[model samples]
Target: MARRKKTSPLEDVLDLLAMLPWWACVMLAAVSYFLLHPLAAPIQASDIQGQGGAMVGAMMQKAVIHGLATAGQHIVPLLCLAAAALSAWRRKQRQSLLTEVAQARNTDALDGMSWREFELLVGESYRQQGYCVAEIGGDGPDGGVDLVLAKGGEKFFVQCKQWKAYKVGVTTVRELYGVMAAKGATGGFVVTSGRFTEDAKEFAQGRNIELIDGPRLFAMIQRARQTQGPSTSEHRESAITTGFPQVQAKASVTEPTANSQATTRPDCPRCGAAMEQRTARQGANAGNAFWGCSTYPKCRGTRATG
Candidate 1:
């Protein structure tokens, strides 16, 4: 038979002693009341002179006894409170080890990986979390947005720039908007290892685009790593229901930009969004300057012909 562990004798004594103050105060008060019993006779006495010197002497004796008794009552309670605190300290020490263990688990769950792998991981992870993935890539004539994914029948295009350390500016996200419109995507995702400029983040808000920067990317990766098993692609192969093209953007195309806020291109003939600078593939103006619609995969509108 297994023996039950017994509490230390010292701990047991401290616990009992700690609770004694509350009871001790009550006991002292009772004792003090009893010690003042002789004082009750003074109330019945008709007058001081009628009671005589002997009564006065008895009253003084009662007062001294009651005073000492009251002092002991208060002092004993304080001592009891001190003991109780010491007992609580020991209990807290025992529970602290358990608390540390729980915290360690949480910390490990939020600091798993680096930022460079975020974009690839996020889309893959999102698919694992039950979404369809549509990867778009391979040298067409728009930005290098390589993927689009969907969940619950809702579509979102993804632009993955593997800039491991540099900040992504507004121009990159602006290009994604065009691809989103072209694909008729419900929304867009721009995932990068570096941070987004304030302007870029502001452009994403209220738009159908979401920006996942370095910090958020790292956190998500950490969460994914904590639940480690396999790369996201293997787990959710069935849910990835889209057959997307691997089209690549051509060379750099020059588009007109007059004012800072003005549209880079006239308008996307396909999606009606503003066209941006992009190069065409296998054309005499292949490397020449032309404006292409911001909505590439969905719209495929180019101003090169215009």
Candidate 2:
């Protein structure tokens, strides 16, 4: 197995800052420069000439502060800017990976990626879903837990398995469950680039553990890309103001007036036409609201409501 390279202290600090948003790091750079520049400036000679002995101690302290601040004023800002650039690059890379996988004709895109790339892709997917995701860099390709997701005051654990040929088995699911229990996580997810065993599927059922296989994970990324506007916080605030639960872009409850419908309805999957809330009058799913293509007779596309 290939060992992970040891990072220097500066590299570690860069990595920590890179986890923050790029804009935030840029702001920190500005703030640090303004705060340190004054301290770094030359001390006035007149201010130190009044007190003889006390002046020496004070001057020495000021010199130490000045020296440190002189170096720090440049180094700290540079580090922040560098980390900001790295953060922006990583965000762009995640988007690229997401787009590549979402547009792929099959699961080959996922199967061909390295394990680190797969973990990044998974983290990006969760981020798109409005979760603040913290990547817990793993020991290796088959490391224990790869992500820590936080949302709505709840925490979840995620394990990414990039195995191409082998099926994820029940043991992996069990391990995640154990970790979740130990860590007091609300839930857990095991996402793999391949299928899961029947035993694995059975074990995850009713266990608050979601097992996402290649196809489902691909669909999730595609959905996240399609509905990538108006953050979760915005949705929650709107829900509070309107006295309604947060509505998903893909589905909504039926409303009496057409004007009262959600503005962010999804387009038809088949014809790419605007879809509207529809009610099923007959069959097994009667009285249920669904999204139907506006040109229903011409384009028979339909989607289920949430």
Candidate of highest lDDT:
2
lDDT of 2 by residue, 1-306 (tens): 122488898898998788777777899999999999999999888757548789899899889999999999999999999998997787778888988888788777887787878888998887667666776665534338888766545667898888867899999999889888888887788899899999998898757677889987888888877777424422322222222332333433333565674445665543335688789999989999998888756455566777
Model 1: how far residue 80 lies from native, Å: 82
Q: On a 0 to 100 scale, what is the lDDT of residue 134 in model 2?
A: 71
Off by over 4 Å in 1: 1-119, 225-235, 241-306
Q: Over all chains combined, what TM-score does candidate 1 have?
A: 0.38
TM-score against truth, every candidate: 0.38, 0.70
What number of clashing residue pairs does each candidate have, in the order they appear?
16, 0
Tens-digit lDDT string for candidate 1 (1-306): 011246687555544454222334345445645554443433334443336788888667766665665665555455455555653443343223223322343423223333322333555544434445543341345466656565434566777655644688899889889877886777777876567889898787657677776565555444443443434433343343223322222223354456644342353332224567766666566667677657555444445534
> Whose TM-score is greatest here?
2
* Model 1 global lDDT (CA atoms, 0 to 1): 0.51
Instruction: Provide C-alpha RMSD values for all models, in order.
Output: 26.0, 8.7
Q: Least lDDT summed over 10 consecutive residues: which range in candidate 2?
A: 233-242
